[model samples]
Target: MNGMERISSFIDSYIEDDEGLLNEILSEAIKNRVPVIRKASKEFLRTQLLIKEPENILEIGTAVGYSSLYMSNYIKPNSKITTIELDEERANLALENIKKLGKEEVIRVIKGDACKVLKTLPDASYDFLFVDAAKGQYINYYEEIIRAAAKNAVIISDNVLQDGEILESHYTVEKRNRTIHDRMREYLYKITHDKRVCTSILSIGDGMTVTIKLSD
Candidate 1:
């Protein structure tokens, strides 16, 4: 393994394993091939929430509600999370999981396409935004997310690197994935260049971007 791999492995070795019913369920979901946040990304998010202590969070994708539940552990009391999922099965599962955790009052799962659901949310409603769905529509999501975010909001975007393919030329990407690749690049460019946010792209967990919204 290279230097970065070695460093990641060392960090993984030192990270404590979570022991709880929710974590156990998350482990099972991962074993079943459900897409959840990677270890590094999870750690980054945990730290961010601890520092920001956001009162309201908007999550664009609720795969199995794992990330939402994981975040619930870190946010301040009375904080709320609104997560969107387009898949009916996943949305129902998410609700079940939230209810099981007795966090029904803390987390709400909205079943619908995020592109449409986001339009209904009022401006400056969320102090933190997590985007992890429909890579091709990231730019679209970003636009709506900015409208809904509070000034100085923290936006965490996952899978922005497309497994490192994003660094490769567009011609090198598979035709089927070119659209997503191009769109991700565009999204990165906009966030990094926009005066409204200070963005940092990190090579963690398929790549992640952390943006802090700035006042105009």
Candidate 2:
């Protein structure tokens, strides 16, 4: 087997799950080669929704609408989600999945570049923002998410650890990934040190950082 195949096999062997559907989806993601949220990250965000019951949520990525539907499962029936995705093929697939899940009314998938689409949203409009799109654009997403978050709003950024790459020295990462790695480190530092936000980095799937806007 190839390197990634071997690695995935090893990881899967150690992964345990009590949630049947989640386990199924995760296995499907690996089998179908779809990118879905990791098990731990998904559960953590689900629990946060249970606690916050956000009136509105903005998701920067909608890969087959897995996470959005996952969030919908936890949120109140009346709450709404606006998710953005750039890939037409994946966007269509996400729409189909959301329809099957009977959450079309609650989750709206916008088709376009997330950064550009986010510009059209009114300021301070979302109670929660999830960043899970292109890794290189995390900082840009962070800026937009911060602008869109309402007072006390929470922003959850997934894959912050980049599979532990962030822990390596910059020179060790591939050239293409170095910039993103550095930028993510800077973003993580900013989020944790910024006085206007209370942030915690949790070692969930890959890694997740939760940030809540503090009072002005």
Candidate 3:
């Protein structure tokens, strides 16, 4: 089997039947090509965020707010989550979902370009960050994300493996996909080598890199 197929099998084996309602919504979203964080990855982020009990959580990509709401259901009371999205349609839908779930008080959706919105956040204030936005911008986003994260904060970047696409040389990928492949590789390289963050690339759904900001 190919790398992606192998990883899919692994995730399937370990993934459990948790969060039934969330899973149902995710399934519907997937059917409509409305991207949401993978079930396994969302569960992983939920568990980690619950443990961290972050006071301020910042999410770069709020794809329909599935992951944000999932984390909200598990995290400590009164913890605030600020998620950014560029698409107006998705943002509206996410806002509706938040209100439907009665999470509007805890989960806030900021409609704008992620990089631009991130600039307005105070430095070193976020205790946790969830990045699931454009693959080509992961490295660029990381720079800003780290600046916004608190000391020893946790940052999770989804789709780092890009379905094992990063393992292939850029030239081998289709011309249209080459740029994204190259950028993902560059992002992975920078994250792995950076001394300020301790990083681990897990062979989970599409691959996720979990990083912790080092205490200065």
Candidate 4:
């Protein structure tokens, strides 16, 4: 393992939260080969939710509802999670899991395109946003995300680094991936340079960006 991997592994070794249903969900996801957040990412998200105590949370992806249910654990009981999933099968499965786990009361699964659904949301309503959907569409979603974010809202985006391929030359990437590569770079540049939010890109699992909105 490289230095960053070694450090991440070492830090993960100390984590032992007795996740009850969360563990079951994770196991089911693993069994089904469904993608979920990395352990380090989950912990980082948990820490942020605990500290922020956001009342309204918006999740751009709900693959089997793992991360939404996970986030529900750290937030106040009254806090609500609105997660969007574009895939019909995934959205249905996510709803099933949420209801089966008795988290339907706090979490709602929206079956639709986030690109369209985000535009319908009330402006400046959500205090916390977790984005883990399409890589190429991140730039498309950024404007609506900023519009939907409450003042000082916290936005966490996952899988921004494309498994470290982002550093490679554009011509080196396969033709099929070039579009996503270009868009992710654009998204990163905007996130880092945008005056509305202060962002820190961390070399976490698959890379992540933590950003805080300065205002509407």
Candidate 5:
């Protein structure tokens, strides 16, 4: 492993593990090859919610309900999380998991394309928005995301670097990744340059972007 890997391993080593049903859900996701947030990213997100305690959380992806259920642990008892999943199977699995975990009241899984579902949401409805879906679609999701965000909303996007592909030249990357590479770069540029938010792109969990929508 290299320096960054060593650092990440060290950090993961120090972080606490999830217990009980949460741990079981995480294990199931891992066994089924679902890509939930990484250890570093999980801790980062948990801490973010603990600090912000947002009342309304919006998530772009709900893979087996791992991330949403995880976030539910950190937020206030009354806080609500609405997560979207494009895959019907995943959405159903997430809904099942939510029911099993007895989080039906706190977390809801919506089955549909996030791009369309986001349009249906009220403007300024969410205080914390988590984007963890199709990498190429992130740029496409940006406008609706901004419109759905509440003033001073905290927007957290995961996998922004596409596993270290963001820094590589288009010619160097594989053809399969070229589209995601280009779109991710554009997404980064757009969010960082936009005057409505203060964005910080960090090299955590495939890379994460933390943006705080400025109050108008």
Candidate 6:
């Protein structure tokens, strides 16, 4: 394996595997070709949640509730997760899964486009925000996320690297994907350069960026 792969494997080796229905959900997601967080990305997020212990979490994408339920495992008791999904089918499935897992009270699936839904949330409402929606809308979502985030909030954006495409020249990307590539680059630039947050881009999973908002 390559260096990063080797490191990921090593880290996963030490991390205990999830048990029971959670493990089953993850397997089912992978089997169905649903895009959930990578193992490495999950581990990274687990660590962050453990440290932050955020009471209110906002997630831009809820794909079958895999990440939401997975996060429910680590968050403090009585903590709340607000997740958005544009696809009605997926949102219904996610709500079903959340109920099945007995997390219906803890995780609420917002059925709507995140771009519009985010605007309705009260300002400074969330202590942690996770963005994993349509890559092209990341910049747009970022604007609302920042507005809704509390001071010192942690913001994690997944798939920022676009499977390593972010590092390549825009001309090198496929024509259909170039818009997403350019927008992702713009999102990365805006987050990293914004003085209110300190951001770190990591080459884990498809690639993830972690940002902590420093101001209101």
Compare the candidates by TM-score and give the number of the best one: 5
Provide the TM-score for each candidate, comma-separated: 0.95, 0.87, 0.92, 0.95, 0.97, 0.95
Q: Flag clash pairs in model 3.
A: none
Minimum summed lDDT over a 10-residue window in model 1 is located at: 10-19
Q: Which residue pairs in model 5 clash with each other?
A: none
Worst 10 residues of 4 by lDDT: 14-23
Q: Which stretches of candidate 5 lie over 4 Å from their true place?
A: none
For model 2, what is the alpha-carbon lDDT of residue 118? 88
Q: TM-score of predicted model 4?
A: 0.95
Count clashes in each candidate, considering only residues at least 3 apart in sequence or on different chains: 0, 0, 0, 0, 0, 0
Q: Per-residue lDDT for 72 in model 2? A: 83
lDDT of 5 by residue, 92-122 (tens): 9899889988999999888999988989999
- Displacement of the residue 116 alpha carbon in candidate 4, Å: 0.7
Instruction: Please report, in order, the local distance difference test score of every candidate based on alpha carbons.
Output: 0.90, 0.84, 0.84, 0.92, 0.92, 0.91
Residue 93 in model 1: lDDT = 87
Candidate 1 similarity to native, TM-score = 0.95
Report the C-alpha lDDT of model 3 over 89-176, residue by residue, as the tens digit. Answer: 8889889878877898899999999888888989899999988999998877877888899998999999888777677877788888
Summarize candidate 6's per-residue lDDT along 1-216 as a digit string, tens digits. Answer: 887678778877877777898888888888989888887788899899999999999999998999999999999998999999999988998988898899989999999999899999999989988999899999998878999999999999999998777788888888999999999999999999999899999987888999999986
- Candidate 3 TM-score to native: 0.92
Against the hidden true structure, what lDDT does model 6 obtain?
Answer: 0.91
In model 1, the runs with Cα more than 4 Å from the true position are 1-6
Candidate 1 per-residue lDDT, tens place, 125-177, comes to 89999998999899998878999999999999999987778888889889999
Candidate 4 residues lying further than 4 Å off, grouped into runs, are none
